[model samples]
Target: MSTSRFSSYQPFFFALVLAFGVFIGVMLGPIMGSKPTPTQARSTYTRMDSILAYIDNRYVDSINTDSLLDVMITNYLNDPATIDSFFKFLDPHSNYIHKEDLQGFNEDLEGNFDGIGIEFNILNDTILVVTALSGGPSEKLGIQSGDQIIRIDDTLVAGIGVTNQQVMSMLRGKKGTVVEVDIKRRGENELIPFRITRDVIPVHSVDVAYMIDDITGYIKVNKFSANTPYEFADAVIKLNSRGMKQLILDLRSNPGGYLQGAVSLADQFIPGKELIVYTEGRAVGRTEERSGKAGLFEQGKLIVLVNEGSASASEILAGALQDNHRATIVGRRSFGKGLVQEVYPLPDTSAVRLTIARYYTPSGKSIQRSYANGTDAYYDEYMQIVMNGDADSVNGRKA
Candidate 1:
C-alpha cells in the first residue's frame, strides 16, 4: 500500500519542479547574455542625468535642451558663487569662454583681427576717435585722431549714448566687408563720409620703442600675445641701431597674456641656459624654461617697470629678470599673478581656462599673492594701496 501511494504522487512532483526550472531560466536569460549600449558603456548615469530626466518628464513648460545646458554650464563655470558647496572652490582667473566669444578672445591673443581698426573713446555722448591703428583700414582711409564719429553705416551714433561694444560691432566685420562712417573734423565744418573696408589689422604688443636719451631706450609693452616676441625683437633691433646701450621696459598697467611671450621676453635678458621660469602642477609635472639662444639687448642695463596693474605674464617676466639678477625691477610692487592657466577646448568649440600650475622664478619663489580671503578681498587689497596713497611710495612699501 505505501509503494502504490508514492508512485501516484511522483508525476505531480516532477511537473512542479520542471515549472520552477523554466521560471528561473526565463528570468536569468536576459541578464546572462545582455550587452550595454554605447551610451551606457561610455558613462554611468549621474546626478546631472537624473536632474535632466526629471526636468524633461515633470517640467511645466517646454525647454530648449541646448540652451538649458549652456546656461547650466555658464552659471557654474563662470560664477563660482553660484556653484554648490562641493564645487565652490574656484579661482577668479579660471574662466569659461563661450563659443561665440572664443573667436574674439583668440584674436586678441593672436594679435590680429578683421576690423576697421581704430581706438575710440566715448566722450560727452559722442564717439571720439583716439587714433586709427597704423596700417589699418581706418588709418589708410585717412581717419585721423580727434575726429568725432557722427554716424556708423546708416545708424546715427553721435549723441545717442552709443556704447563701446556697439561701436566695435559696427566697425568689425568679415574681411572685404565695407563699413561707412561720417566723421566731423576739428577744422572742417562738413561731415566727412568715408567707406572703410575691413581687413586684418595687426594688434601690436610693443606700443612704442624709442630712445629716451642718447644711450637709453624705452619700450612700452601693452600685453603679451603670440606676436609679442617678434614685435619685441624688432623693437630691440630698431633701438640697437639707434645707439641704445640701456633699456627701460615699461610694463606699468599692463595686464599680461601668453606665458610663451613672457618666457621669450625673459630669454632676451637672461644669458646662456639659465633658468628663467619653472612650472609645477598635478597634471603637468615640473617643467623648466631656460635661455637657449643668443638674445638681443642681453648686454644692456635692463630695467623692468611694474605697478599694481602689472600681472600674469608681466609678473613672470619681472620675476624671471629679478631672480636671474639680470634686470632691476623698478616702480611699485607687481600685481601678484603667478598661476599658469591652460586653455582646454571642448567639443562645442568653447574653452575652459583652468589654472593648471603655479609658476616660480629661478629662485623657486612664487609671485602669486594669497587669495584665501576670496577674489573680492584679493582685488580690494590691491585697490586699497591707491586709496591709502601707498601706491605713491617707492617699491610699494608703506613708510
Candidate 2:
C-alpha cells in the first residue's frame, strides 16, 4: 500500500516539474538564443515605415500609393515648417519638378521637342503665334508670325482666357501625330484651317543674328541651352563674314539655363586662361571655371546687353565679361541671381533642382540678392523696382 501511494505522488511531482520547465523556456525565449518571429521583428521598423504600414493595412479606404507618395513629397518640400533645421533659409529656386513636367523641362534645356513647332504668346485673351518655327510643319503649312489661333481641334480656344499651357497641350503631341488648328490671320475675314503633323523641332537659343551697322553685329540670345554654343558659333561665323568688327550680345529679358552653356559663351569672349566664374558651397566646395581653347569672338569689341530680366546663366555670362573687362555691360542692372542649382533625379522619374552653391565672378562678387525676408518680399522688391522705373534705367541714367 505504501509503494502504490508513492508511485501516484511521483507521477504528480514529475508532471509539475515539466510544466515549470515549459514556463521558464517561454519567459526566457527572447532574452536567450531564440530568434524573433516575423511579427516581433516588424516592431523594430522606423516611425515612417510604421505609419506607412498602418495606412496600408489598417486604413479605412484603399489608395494609390504612387500618387500618395508624390503628393506627400510635394507638400513636404513646399511646407516651410517641414524644412530641415540645418538649412538656415529657404531657397525659392530649389524646387521639386513633377514627373509629368519633367519631360518638358528636360526638353527646354535639351534644345528639342516633338511638336508642330510654333512660338506663341497669349495677349488680350488670344493665342497669337509669334512665329512658326523654321523648317517646322506649321511653317511649311504657311502658318506665319502674328497669326491668331482661334480653334484647336473642335475646341474654340480664342478669347477664353486660355493659358499658354493649354495651347501647348493642344498643339504638342508625339512625332507623326497630327494636330488641327484654325487661324485668324491679320487681314482675313475667314478662318484658315490647317492639319500639321508634329515632329522633332529644334529649339534655337540664338533668336536672331544680323549686322546692325557696317561694323556692329547684334545677336539676341533667348536662353543658354545645350545647343547655345553651337548656335552662337554659327552666328559669329555669319556675322564675321558680314564685316562685323564689334558684337552686341543681347541678354535682355533672358532667363538663364545650363551653367556649362554660360561658361562656353564666356570662353568665346574672354581669351587666355582667365577665371570666368567660380562656385562655392558647404558640401560642393570651391569649383573654378576658366576660359579654355581659342574663341571665335575673342578679338572683337564685345558689348553685353542685360536688364532686370537677365538672371542665372545670363548673369554669369554678363558678370564674367564685366569682371574681366572683356565687354561693356549695357542696359539696366542684371537680375541678381548667382545661385547654382544641381538637378537630382528621384526614383519616380521626377526631379529636384536644389540650390547647391553660390556663384561669384572672377572679382569674387556674389550677385545674388538677399532673400532673408522670404520669397514674396524678395519678388516684391523686384516688382517695386519695375514700378519705380528703376528697371528701365541704365548706369544711373534713364533709357
Candidate 3:
C-alpha cells in the first residue's frame, strides 16, 4: 500500500517542477533575449565589411559608390561657394563653415587676428590693396593704399588666375611671422619688394567713437560681434568722461553677430526690467529676454541709426530700444533678419549654421519681412525697393 502511494505522488512532484521551470523562464525571457545595443552590434562587423561586400557583389565594371560618395560630400563641404548655395536654399543668412574657414570666422567674431593687416580686393584679376589698416604691420612697413600685389614671395601672382582666397592665405599668418610681397605702386618703373612682419590686427566693430562736441558723442557699430559689447562699453565710458550727455549709436550696414552681444549692448541703454526680445519656434518654447544691469547711459538722449543693411542682432538691439521708446530710430528700413541661428559642429570640424528660432521685439513685432519667395527672390527685394524709390525713405515711410 505504501509503495502505491509513493508512485502516485511521483507525478505530482514532476508537475510541480515543470510549473516552476516555466514560470522562471517567463520571468527572465526578456533579459535573456533582448536586442544588443548599437555598440555591441558594431563589434560583430569589421569597419570595411560593407565596403568589401559592395565591391564583391557589385556587377558593374567600375563604380566605387562608397568612396565616390565620401569624396563628393567632402568636396561639396570644402567649397565655400557650393556650401553657401546649400544654406541659401533654406534662408539668406544660414551658412556653412568648413574647418579651413573656421580660423577666419573666429577672428571675425573675436575682432582680432594676427596678419600683415591690409584689406585687398581682386579687381580685374589683380590684387589691389584697398587700405593698409592704420597701425598694422603693413602700415608700419610703409605699405600704402592703392598698391597692387604683383608677386607674393617667389610666385608671380599678377595677372594670374589668383583668387582672393589665395591672396589672403599668402598674407595672413602667425604673429612675428614674415611675408614678403612685391608691390606695384603707381608711376613706379620696378616692383617694390618688402618683408612685413605680421602682428596683431584689431577688427573694430565700433569703427569710431568720439565726442562730437561738449555734450554730444557718436559711436558707429559696423557689426555686432563677440567683442562688440565690451568695445561699446569702453567707448561709452570714454565719451562720458569727455562730457558726452547725448549719444548717437550708428548701426548702418551692420550685418550683426552673436545675439548675446547685442543683448548686452542694448542693456547698456535700456533701463530696468523691460522686455528686450523674445524668441519662439516649433520645437522650442517661447523665451523672453529682458533688460537688466545698471545701464551706463540710460538717462542720456539716445539715437540709434539703422538701414536696410542692418540685420539679425542689429534688428534685435534696434527693436528693443525702439519698442521701449528708449531711443530714436533713424535711417531706412532694417534688413529684418529676425531669424536666430544656432551652429552645430560636426565630428570632422566642419559646422552647419541652422535657423532655429524667430525673434520678436518686446512689443510683439516681428520685423522679419518675408522669405516665402525663396532666397534669390528674397534678396532681390532690396533691389526692387531701390528701383521703386522706397529705399530712400526713413522710418520705412516716404522721406
Candidate 4:
C-alpha cells in the first residue's frame, strides 16, 4: 500500500501496530521500489493475527484508538516503556520521538533553533566553544571560539557530567530572553561574564569557513540540515573572493541529516551531468539524483574529511565524491548509514521515523554496513573497528 493510503488508517489499530513493526524490524540500504498491485487475500489466522483481526473487525468507531493503544499496551507489554525498549532492536536510527521532544527534533532538522548561538563540545569535561556563530548573540558579546562555558546562570556545569542536551536546555529559549554564562578564557584569571539576549539562532550546516594560510580554504560542516547547500555555497563564494585555490570540506563528527542537502553539496564539487546517488526498493523504483549546472567550487582542488562519526548524508556526499573522483577523502571510515527515513507525525503529536529506502552511491554500492546481528552489534562493529586498529584501513567498498 502507498504510505499516504496506509497512514490514512491512523484512526485505526492496525496502522499503529504496523508502524511499530516498521520502527523495529526494517533494515537500511534498500529502497522500496514501485511494484504492481497484489491481490488482497485473508490467508493466515494465527494468535497475534487473530488479535489484530479482532481489533480491525470488532473495535467500535466512537472508541479512541490512541487510548486503545495505551490500554492494549498496558495489558500486553505491561507499559509503553517496554514497547519503547523493544522497538530499538529494529534499527540503530529508527525510533519514536515523544511529543515533548518532537519540537526540538524538528527544530534541529529545520536548520534554525533559538539559542545564544554557539557550537560547543564537552572536551576534558568542560563545555568548550567550538565556534561562536557569526552574527549570533554570543558573538555579539565578544565570546570567542576558544572560550569555555563553566557555568550557566548560577549552576557550575563544568566537570559535573553535564550533557549536551542539558546545556542546550539552559541556553536555548524564546527570542528576547536573556541568558547569563560564565566563560573561561586563556590567560584570564577570573571567569568572564556575559549576558546574552537569546534570539533565533541559524543552526548552520557549514559551521565555519576560513582561508587557511594563503590559498587553502577550510569549511567545517556540522550537519546536513535544510539550508546546508545554500549556506555552503555562500561560504564558498566568500572564500573564492579571498583567493582560495584549494578547499578542505570537513565532515568529521557530523552525524548526517537531509539527503537532498548531501546531493546539493556533492553537486557543488562534481562538474557536468554526473550521477551522485541512487535509490531502489521493492515499492519505490530506481530514483537517481544527478549533478545539473556547473557547481560553485567545480574548478577548485577539493578534499573531503570524514571519520567514524560521519554518517548517512555525510557518507552519501563522500561516496559521490569518491565515485566521481572529484575529491580526496581523508580520515577514517564513515559511519555506515545507507538507509533513508521518512518522519510521520502521529495524531497525538508524537512522531515515528520509518526506514523507507536504501540508498546507493554513484558506483551502485550500498552505504550501509551490516546490521544482521542486531542494533547493538551493528553499533559495536564500529567499536570493533577501532579496537582492531582498522580505522585507517580503507576497505575500498565504494559505498
Candidate 5:
C-alpha cells in the first residue's frame, strides 16, 4: 500500500508525464553569485530552517539536522541518487534539477536545444547511447541507442562518475565545432570512435493537430514551449471552422512550459473569475490566475490525454480545466508539480528560478508535491516506481 508520503507525490506530477521531452519546472538562465533580495533571502532561509528542523526533530532516529540537511543538499546536487530515493517515499513528482541539468531538460521540453545532438544515459557508470539525433552526425556515423560511449577523446567515461552534466559539457560545444566520441555497442565489443561536428537542432513542440476525423481534431502537444499557446490557439481556430466537435488535446508526454502561456490557453476555456490556480509564498502575496475569455473548452467535449509525464504548466492547465469540469482528463493522473518558481535577476545577467510559492488548485489542493526531505528522496522514489511498475498509482486521490 502507498503511504501518505507516497500519496503526497501526486500534486507535483499533475504537470509531467516523464517524457524525455520534458524538462524542469523552472526555466533558469545564467546567474552570477549575488546576495539574495531581502524577501528572497527570507524565503531561502525559511526553507533551510524548515529542512533543518525537520531533520533535527522528526527523524525517527537521532541525527544532526544541520549537517544532514547540508549533506542532503550536497547529495541532491552532487548525486542524482539523493533525489531518486527521496521521491520514492514522499512526493515522487518533485524534481531536483540543478542549473547544469537544464540542458537535458530544455532539450526534452523543447524537443531540441543547442547541443551536439546525442541521446545518452548512464548504465553501470558507462555512458550508453539511448539514441542519437536522426539524420545527425551520430546516426550518420552508425551510433545506436544500445551503443556505449566508452570514451570522449582519450578521456574514459567509465569507472569515474561521469554525470549527464559532464557528458553534455563534453559533447555540446559551440556550433561548427567538433567532438570526438568513442562507443562500444552491444554487438561490438571493441570501442569505435567517431568525430562529430556540432550543429543547431530544430525542435518541434507542436505535434500535428489536424482533423483526425470530421468531428475530432487530434493535436499532440509534446511540450509547452514559448510558441505553444500561439500555435495551439491558431490550430483551435482553424479546427473550429472545420466543424470539430470533439477535440483530443493530447498532453501525454508534455512536461510543461511558461505559466502565462498555460493561463492564456486555459483562459480560452474558462469564461471569467474562475480560479485556475493560486500561489502563496513568503514574499509573494496570494497571486491568483484565472481563465479570461479565450479558451476553446466551452464548445466541445474536450478530452485531455494525460499520464505520469504531464507536468508544471501542463498540470496547471489540466487542473484548471478538470477543476472546472471543462474537460474530461483521461489516461492516468499527472506529475503533481505545484511549486511555483520565481526567476529573479542575478548579477551575471542570468536568473535564479527559486521555489517561491506552492500552487493550489481551485479546490485547495496543494499541487506541489511535498518536498518533505528536500529533492533527494523525491527522485529516488520515482526510480523505485519504475522498478516496481507502480508509476500508474503515483497519484492517489485524496479525500
Candidate 6:
C-alpha cells in the first residue's frame, strides 16, 4: 500500500489529502474492529450463498450476475475519460482524479511537486499567488507572494472556470523543462513575462522548528507523513545536540496521514502502555492503539499545539500524548476528523480510500466533525459562512 520507493516516505501524501477537503471522499466510511478469524470467515460464507445459489439454480439470462457486476464495476473505474466527463456533469466539488491526475492532486496536497512551486488562488479570473517557495522558479524570477499570475505560456490564466489543475498542468513538467509565465504585479498594470524552469522540489512536513528560547526547542509539524517519525527523531537529535532540554510540538494545520506514521512519531515521545486513540463503527468492533516502548524524549518538558485543522492522525498523536500526560496541548479546538480511511487499490490502478470509523481521543471526545447535512453542503458550509460575512473567516465560522 506504500506506493513510494522509500519506505520511510510511505506516508508522504496521505496526510496532506485531508487538508484539501477532497479526502472527505478519499478518507471516506465504517470500521470493523474485529478481524475475520476462521469462524468469522465461516460466517461470511452465507453472505454469498443466496447469489451463488441463484446463479446456479435459477435466473432467465446467462446467470452471470455476480461476474457481470464485477465486470461493470471494473470497467466503470477503468475509464478515466468517462469518469472525468461524469464529474464535469456533477457538482464542481465532486471531482474524479485519474491515475494521471493523482500526481498533480498530490502536489496540491503536500504544497510541492515537480513544478514552479507557487501556491495561487484564482481571484476574479486572475491567478494570484498565495505564497511562493523561496527557492522555486517563481520566487527566483521575482514573483512576490501577492503577484498576479496573468498567463502560463501563451494561455491567459484568468477567467471563470479556470481550475487549479490547469495552472499546474501548464507550469509543471519534467526537470530542465522551461515554461513561460506572465505576471501582473499589484503595484503595476504592466504584464511581466518570465521563463521558469521546472525542477524537483522537496515538500516539507516540518512547518516550523526553532528555539523557543535558549532551552526550549519548538517544532510545528503539520502531519505525520512519510519519514515523519524519522524526521522527528533527527530533529530531536539535532536539538538535543544543541542542548535543548524541553520541546514544544505544534500540530496546528495537520489533517492527519498514515495512522502508523502517527503511531511511529508518537512512539518517540511516549512510553509504557497507553491508549492513543480507539475506533468503532458499524462494521467494526473496537480497536485501540497502545503505546509501545519508551519514547526517546520522555525526559523532556513537552507541549503540543493544536487547532481546527488538526484531525485523524493528528488527533491520535495529540490524544496519545495528552492521555499519557506525555505533553501539554495548547491551541483552539481541533477539526475533529477522528475517522480512519483505508486505501484499497483496485485492479485498474485506481483506489478507494474509505473511511473506517470514528476514532476517539483517550478521553472519548469524538474528533469527527459534524457532517450530517450531506457531504457537499457539509464541506461548503465554511465557504458559505466566509461569503456571507464578506471574506471574514473568523466572523463566518463564528456565525
Clashes of each: 0, 0, 0, 16, 47, 16
TM-score (C-alpha, index-matched) for candidate 5: 0.61
TM-score of each: 0.62, 0.64, 0.66, 0.65, 0.61, 0.66
- Residue runs of model 3 more than 4 Å from their true location after superposition: 1-85, 118-165, 176-197, 376-399
Candidate 1 stretches with Cα past 4 Å from truth are: 1-88, 116-168, 174-200, 377-399
User: Candidate 5 — which residues are off by over 4 angstroms?
Assistant: 1-113, 116-155, 173-198, 345-351, 385-399
lDDT of each: 0.74, 0.75, 0.74, 0.74, 0.64, 0.63
Q: Model 1 over residues 164-249: C-alpha lDDT tens digits?
A: 55777788889999999999987797999999989988777888899999999999997799999999999999999999999999
Query: What would the per-residue lDDT of candidate 4 be over residues 1-399, giving only the tens digit for each residue?
Result: 235533544455576577555422321113212221222113433344334434444567544444555566568763445656655545666777766657767776675777888766665578877567667888888997567789899999999998656777899889999889999988899999999999988766777899996999999997888988788999999999999999999998677889999999898889999999998755777789999978888987889999887888999999999999999999988788898888998777888887767889999999888766777787666656533443321111000
lDDT of 6 at 287: 89
Off by over 4 Å in 4: 1-80, 116-171, 175-199, 380-399
The TM-score measured for candidate 2 stands at 0.64
Per-residue lDDT value at 221 in model 3:
86
Better of 2 and 5 by TM-score: 2
Q: For candidate 2, lDDT tens digit of each residue in 1-399? A: 124433645765676456445433433344423443446436654343344444544568976544565576578655534443213334646766666656777776774778998766665588767567667788889987667789999999988887656777878889999888899986799999998899988777888999989999999987898989999999999999999999999998677889999999999889999999999887788999999889998988999898887888999999999999999999887788888888899877877778878889999999898776766677666656544533321111000
Tens-place lDDT per residue, model 6, 46-67, is: 4333333334334566555446
Better of 1 and 6 by lDDT: 1
> What's the CA error at residue 3 for candidate 2, in Å?
88
